[model samples]
Target: MMGRTVLVTGGSSGIGRAVAARFAADGADVVITGRRVDTVAPAAEALGVRGLACDATSPGQVAALAGELGGSLDVLVNAAGGLPAAPAAGTPPLEALAQEWLSSVSGNVLTAVLTTTAVRDRLAPGGAVISVGSIGAERRGGSYGAAKAALAAWNVSLAAALGPQDVTCNVISSGYVAGTGFFGDGMTEERHRALVEETLLKRPGTPDDIAQTILFLASPGARHITGQTIHVNGGAFTTR
Candidate 1:
């Protein structure tokens, strides 16, 4: 990883931060991005990596990010995403639903799509494109889950397109990762216990768990593995 260049979006905290830390530790040139300068700047400084503030969904900002790279990239991690904001009180039901669904798709799916597109040409032959998905896509994930499901579907085509260049693309579908501020005020003690019980491992997943999986996918050993959705959940959801 000495000469490799890696980019991670939404890397200010949580799983993205963990991924940046891992690659930086291995001596890779790592750059992290978040929407806010306040968050991105400190996280980058603390992790000893470059930080760029860019809203991945915006084409203009993404293009700027690409221009800044001005060279090749070895890894791109689409780790920036989350649930949509709650609608204002008394907002029309249909309008609220529309906003929620649209935001969900944009935040989870388009972020990856736009960011990857911006850096696609910059990705070297041995590079890997990895996106963070969620278990919500399987259960009662609602709009958020549906967006994640869409992300997996998109990865297949992306892998095919990038395969000829020796660039592997995949999605890491995570489940019940703790300490991510993902659940926010919605998570409860009872719910947490139930989630852990549902997993065969009887434990919650963590940022490092997802980070490690991304590292493996970007390594030489996983060169043959692409265009597949890799579930990192702790046996909470089974695939047939």
Candidate 2:
């Protein structure tokens, strides 16, 4: 990865932070972006990489980020998303449901769409575009799941279009990963145990687990693996 330029959105924490650190460890010129400057700046400094503040879901911000990059990128990791927030109190039931659904779609699907489109021309040939998906897309994923499923669907067409350019695109559907605030402050002990029990490994996944897969997809060995959603759920869900 040395001398290669890697861009990771939402790299201020969680899976994104891990991915950025992994690439930086391999000597890649890594640049991480988050919506907040204060958070992203510290994370970038800690990882010893450059940091940019950009709200990926916004076209204007994404365009600004692309402009900052000077139209050159070797790898793009779209890890800028998470579970949707709960509906606000005093909101009507129907409106609350709608808000939750829209939040999920915007955070998970729109973020990737806007960012990838903004940087499409900047993507170097033979580069990789890796998006973070979720196992929720498989079972009772609700709005978050639906959004992630859409992400995979979009990646297929994206792969087809970019394949001719020697670029690869794929999605990584992650399972119940630990070490991040993904579950926020609502993760109960029983729920945590249940999640771990569901996995064959009987343990929750770490950010490094997902980061390692992203690294492989970016490597030369994975050139032929495009337009696929690779599940890293420790046997919680299997694709036939």
Top of the candidates by lDDT: 1
In candidate 1, what are the lDDT values of residues 142-235, reduced to their tens digit? 9999999999999999999999999999999999999988888999999999999999999999999999999999999999999999999999
RMSD of each: 0.7, 0.8
Q: Compared to the true structure, candidate 2 yields what TM-score?
A: 0.98
Q: Which lDDT values do the candidates have, in the order given?
A: 0.95, 0.95
> Residue 211: error of model 1 in Å?
0.5
> Least accurate stretch of 10 residues (summed lDDT) in model 2?
63-72
Off by over 4 Å in 1: none
The Cα RMSD of model 2 versus the native structure comes to 0.8
Model 2, 80-123: lDDT tens digits are: 99988788799999999999999999999999999999888889
Can you give the lDDT of residue 105 in candidate 2? 94
RMSD of 1: 0.7
Provide the lowest-lDDT 10-residue window in model 1: 1-10
